[model samples]
Target: MTDLASFPELLAGYFEIPIDEPGAKAVSDPYGSVRVDVGVIRQEVRSPGYLVSGLVYDVSTGLVESVVAPTQVPTG
Candidate 1:
């Protein structure tokens, strides 16, 4: 397991699937309640946006996987 404290330069950012996108529909009573977070772990502030980069740890394999690569996301 890697310690998150090792990368002080990185900031935590949560990325979720857009509500309007497919597969974001609610499974229960409330419509559009089932939002999913892609789980972006760290990013770098780039003024107008953030440089998104993150990894997912698979407990089944006990390995780290890269889900979201370095990409720029607009804040607006």
Candidate 2:
């Protein structure tokens, strides 16, 4: 509901990592209640030549409720 400006700080606290070290790759809490996946794509023809993305999943519901990328963030 907010913006990416606050995402790193939030993720860091939830994962107990440094703000600059969210380790945004595939990660989940010890209890498996929350899961996060960071995705990257590379293409020579693309505008930026690459892309970075993230997804937050609810393990219990097996649903992806949030998605974030360098350009946008959409929640369900």
TM-score for each prediction?
0.33, 0.28
Write model 2 residue lDDT over 1-76, tens digit each, in one string.
Answer: 1233357777777767788876453333421222233322322224443445545656688987545544432222
lDDT of 1 by residue, 1-76 (tens): 1342233233122123343332232222121221123222222243465566555656688988665566675453
List residue ranges in candidate 1 displaced over 4 A: 1-49
What are the Cα lDDT values of the candidates? 0.38, 0.46
Query: Roughly what TM-score does model 2 have, to 2 decimal places?
Result: 0.28
Model 1's TM-score against the true structure? 0.33
Worst 10 residues of 1 by lDDT: 27-36
RMSD (CA, angstroms), candidate 1: 13.3
Show pairs that collide, candidate 1. none
